[model samples]
Target chain A: MLGLSKKDTTFLLVVIFLTLATPILLQPFPESSALAQFNAGYPDLMQRFAIFGIFAIGFNILFGLTGYLSFGHAAFLGVGSYSVVWMYKLLNYNVVPGLVLAIIMSGLFALFIGYISLRRSGIYFSILTLAFAQMSFNLAYSVLTPLTNGETGLQVYNNDPQVLMSEGSPTSPHFFGIVMNEATKVDVGGWQFTFSNGYYFCAIIAIIVFYLSLRIFRSPFGIMLRAIKTNQTRMNYTGLNPRPYTLAAFVISGMYAGLAGGLLAAMDPLAGAERMQWTASGEVVLMTILGGAGTLMGPVLGAGFIKYFENIFSKINDNILHSWFSALPDGLEDFVVFVFHPFIGKGWNLTLGLLFMLVVIFLPGGLIEGGTRIWNAITGKNRKKKREDAAHHPKPTSHVN
Target chain B: MGILEVSNVNKRFGGLQALGNVNLDIAKGTVHAIIGPNGAGKSTLLNCLIGKLIPDTGTVMFNGISVLGRKPYEINQLGISRVFQTPEIFGNLTVFENMLIPCFAKRDGSFRMHALESIAAERDIIEKAEHMLAEVNMSDKRHMTASSLSRGDKRRLEMAMCLVQEPKLLLLDEPTAGMARADTNNTIDLLNQIHDSREITMVIIEHDMHVVFSLAKRITVLAQGTPLVEDTPDNIKGHPKVKEAYLGEAAA
Candidate 1:
């Protein structure tokens, strides 16, 4: 309906609905239930879901569409965060300027990095990006201490002049008068739902960027990107230069990462050097691959899945484990808890690693492929039945002929 | 005067002289064939024409402009399209997508940012791509992945991809290298039909004499990095230099 085909329109609508209704959907368990710990309706975690979704969606444009595995997206993310915090320090706590500057700064950084990194393809390209990201990380931590504030991170202080701030303005990060931390909590019997302003703000931006990515996926530019991924030799002979196209994609994805970083600081007025670490860069890669690299919904799904597990699964401490298995026989309960100990709580990485391995081995196309397979299996039988029925009762046109 | 002019082209690879002082002129709107036994520098000469190789000392010109040292895309932007020995279509994309890329390249030079516009909105490009696919008889397989197609179908799709751009000059490197007899005949017929239908110039490199005799208007026989003779296909059949190039000196 929005210049998209009927199928793509429907997919986009579904994504929008899911993003908007995440708070209610995530809080499926009631407060009194034993599984209450699994509920992710809280503001902080939900903000992360939307923020990382933007990051992964952008990363997918490069890594997914062009097959350019960038190990340095986290640097853009950090740049975005620092830009927002700098805006807060110089101007007011309003996120708009910071977010705009974040996109511009990250895009500039991406243009510089992408111009050089895109000269080589495949492993060399990946290593070059990795090197650039690490350099940014080290600079932020040590060399750029004057700007980054070194290990202490960049946060607003009382003495710093917020020139835009007035007597009536909100003290913390906000979109104009609307405070990001403000939430309305509702209680219905044992169930509670918290609708946070920050989550919705991130959700709206996430939806917009997601739609943009979807358009890119179906555009002629997207086709060129895929052609680059498949065969550059043919692309050159077809009169298409792969270099400029790849550079554009790199910059675009970098802008996306920067926007995501801006959103991170908007929710909490803090910019940490740790955000640009290699591990942070690696996380986005995992999210894209785990969910589905090229599919429209895969990166978002992957981002949500990893964030949910990271938050809920890591909170499963020994006490919770003991309480869940307390009803069992004493000896058997201890043994069960012991067996599951390494896979939960502090050992969540082990579980994540094992899941990543399984996804790679059995479902190389990622979670989206698995979903498509299951969907096909359900509808395939009905299609076969319909075909048999049609065979049994041939059309009257055949008899007339 | 001809559309393509190659003069005094010399190429050396370390101790080996791949191409040695070669020269040729290819007329417009004609099917010219370059034929030789293995290692006779047929491929090397074709590479020089398409900017894949830079000859040590030579001038390769298309229409009045020199083509030496230009990038492959730049060479193509000057209205020259190349079909590789093995069909070099984007194997990961659909046959229809394969056609759209060349059409986009033709319409929008080398690079463009049409990221926001939907593919369906490009009505003229779509219509042209569809028309080309229909002309190649690959409309039914348009949605099929390019890699899944049979070898003959893949070759046809690759040709369609090139033809959709409507290049003034078309270069084919071994158009039928390892095809079955039936598929080879089909490809020959397709090439003949394409040549008859368009004002395009074609330069084909072939080891198969049957294909050369059927399609080529003029034939150039190369033996050991130099052209032995350039004549009509009928004259080339009786040329003893051509016989020696293919069957060796003992047979001649």
Candidate 2:
């Protein structure tokens, strides 16, 4: 309850509504709407959003709460994806089996890497993680080619067995026991909206995972993790050995990443070594930092923001810009095109880099700050009423030990 | 077997000796106070016992088993708990949550890697934490964040944290080192009450003379790196050698 007040609960509900509804709201807009062309309600993009959202949130568990910056979180995610692909190749093409395999593999990998890397924390820890991630990437690209398919990655082919599901070869049909088709569409008032059955499936998984993470943040272990961030020596003197607790936290976060990775593969039966790249791992780090490291919903918001922009910004071209800017004066069109050309085309990465820097500087708390500010603005006028209620509320028992 | 025993312990940092040939034996359910000057090895001795530091030569035995080469958690599992000079409660945790962690330790032992279970539903742990909080008079502040507590209250919460584990021996380093005179007295009273009520052996490192005299049935005085003398409070207070070597020497 220390972390989850009544206000926070309300805030969480709002976030859940927004994320679940965003795809539908963004999908059906007429072409004239400002957000119509920029929308990423497409199956491929939305699935990526939910997957990376989970990844960023998982990384936040260690870095945000414990003040540990791990450069090798990508290793666990990569291991998870590879393990999931193997499960698909060996067992039935069921999402459930894939998920279990991913989690178990990622947890074990984290245990091994975390054991060694935890030996030296701070900068050394970061370096160790980076080294391990690179080692894993290299192995996936070379020695583990049979399983990982080397640089090209493992893709589902006609010869591959499709045991569990009918339509999606190598990807089992139902998710979390839900009939995917039933969960993906809704019809009302002469309007019909259909998203990828897989997208909604991952969305539900993301919600449940997010809830579990929230519970973790409010638990006793969560408290100790925060203490470790503040004063590890103090916790030790209080009869705690932080190493085990920290390791446990690390493993749990890794499992979450594994879950996300398996979901990624399940949504598309394709395992690419490129997804395991250090850059991909670093992407989640940027998302977590850009959104605000420690806040619960920051990662999700950060992930969505980055993914949406990455999808839209890269689609822009000189032709698209010129068509829109044709309505402008001829003289200013050249000046506008000069500035927009780089960002609208191959220079999307620069836009992301600049946005990340600006967010980290201006809104260090990320989307959570916006949420808090909105809450204050809405509730500020009712402060006296709230306090009055608080005063009359049942006092926590005053009995001394 | 002595419940807790330290034999001929020696510790050196560079050329400086922090503890030299020190020996101690503690039985169950007794309060033992360790008094010393600034450069005395009271803290160092404790650190070695808890496996935070390894002495140059010594073996620490807990309940007939040797405890050297084990981590602090391993030692804690053997029922040896420590409290620092500064209260070390998890600042973000509520007082009740601070109690819950040790209860988890007590119920699960040194390590139980059960990844997913409702820990509160653990009946034994719940009872123990509730009981310990009651013992320390902190049940009311159970839901208050540990960081929000006053200095004395923080110390109280830390003590509750250790008590829930039900250790055979509790090592406290300068429990009353920084406090108002009144708070210090309250802490002394609290310790006396806990020591009286529980079957726990205590080795407290205290700079406060009043606190030491109030609870230590047997006081061991140390100066530089050697034990000055081990005796009752009356004898320790009167001993000329102890006064010149520690009390007077330290204050000067």
Candidate 3:
């Protein structure tokens, strides 16, 4: 079963199926219709979904298993993007070198940060990581302007020497002859499907990273990380130093973030200091938590959910809201649109925050736990009994700890 | 020479001396108990011995190796294990997983990368953990989360976790500190069985006289951060100075 346990193989297969079918699944609305704005099958948004999914999945490996909440993961992501851009400038427009350099550079950066941050646990650890990230962001924005291009960001320019690329080749990132931004469009009876090479590239990497994360979640190393989360004192007395284990998990996650950052650059060919901001880091945290931090599929779902809202729901305006309520009386429709105005369109973050609060207050385990509970209730099974049964007979590939 | 030797140990906390001129020689293959009234530095001494605290001036030698400046995990690698006052099992992990941790430590040394190796495939370690669980009579509850176990069972699991490492020296800080009489007796029996069947040495800090007399071959009574008396359980039971410092009354 692909060198993984049966359950893991199944999970991977399901993810593959869903990822390949994303274009059809996301573009449910017919083109040129009023609801066409809801179509997430567009190349740019689809690429974002897969990229952020990688970011959130990596984050889960750290915060979920080790219980070390890092507020600076986006620093690694930024470093990764910056590294890939440098690779493009010095080497070539080939994504392979750029991505490889991104992962390596971010992994090294993470190693340095994790070494210092892991000396403290809990809130102090979070604060240390945040401070480091903030420091990196500030530096990249100002003092490191030559490297990061300051506020303008780092991007490929025509004057740069691309040693590996011959003259007259496309400047945009490509894998061999296939341009990343190139899309193949298919027209059905009423629906249109866009199959983007960039989206597929990001999707394949995301799935591979997800599978690696699945392996890590079931590995003995993962168990040790969970043990550290459970009781570090016990781990210490058991003759295991938790620092190395935590550091390893941190670096691995940072590399994943770097991969995501590389994919972002491969798609758009730009790197911004703003991507290293604390807000970006918090978004990944939110994605992991909103999905289910420790669950296998949770982070990806959360990433898609957040990205979907950010790209689609935020596009709604007062006119769109009024159109939905147009059937009502004029005055009532105005009032209804006004009441719902602050939660949609430019106020999508408000809705996200409220949803986050609800999940934290009621579903501490996040959306996956909520879904599991609903499933249990629908099946008429006792939740507690099911949990106990799961504890007793844990699935081979599903080691949440 | 004793397996563990502590000499001229001194520990201070600001204005107060927590331990002063403390010296102990614990022979191999014996259960030694250190008892004292509250604040007599019982735990402080245990901490110093287990590398949790660095004595101001002392030498702690275990199997002829100095343990004063080493980390706790390093000390544990030197074949010493400590059971805390409260059970310190990994509450989020299953009881069986809790037991396997020490086995991993023993086999893998302080640290090794065993990430890709599945626990199910590690037949030797799993067998050892399961057998240890069977010995502790916790095989049936091995699947339960460690936190869900009763206080007594947690202590048992903690002890099992330590024993599976086959540590040269076992340090217990009140092994049965908060347990019913029945559980206390059961713990005593378990300790007695372990002591009889293995060549391991144990150092226990306890306030309960019954547990001390039942398991300890030699006892040290501390008073005011110093040893008041050191003798066999029978001799210390009626000693006048021990009564004055610990019992606070003449023996009936």
Best-fitting candidate, scored by TM-score: 1
Q: What is the lDDT of residue A210 in candidate 2?
A: 81
Model 3 ranges with Cα > 4 A deviation: A32-34, A383-401, B249-252
Tens digit of lDDT per residue, candidate 2, span B74-152?
7777887888888877776577777777776666554444433444445676788888888888888888777778899
Best-first order by DockQ: 1, 3, 2
Indicate whether candidate 1 or candidate 3 has the larger lDDT.
Answer: 1
Q: Tell me the docking grade of candidate 1.
A: medium
Badly placed stretches (over 4 Å) of model 1 are A381-401
- What is candidate 1's CA lDDT for residue A159? 91
Per-residue alpha-carbon lDDT of model 1 for B74-141, expressed as tens digits? Answer: 99999999999999989888889999999999999999999998999999999999999999898988
- Model 1, B1: alpha-carbon shift in Å? 0.5
Indicate the residue-level lDDT of A84 in model 2: 69
Q: What fraction of the reference interface contacts is present in each model, in order?
A: 0.91, 0.12, 0.73
Query: What lDDT, from 0 to 1, does candidate 3 have?
Result: 0.90
Q: Which candidate is the best by lDDT?
A: 1
Candidate no. 2 TM-score: 0.83
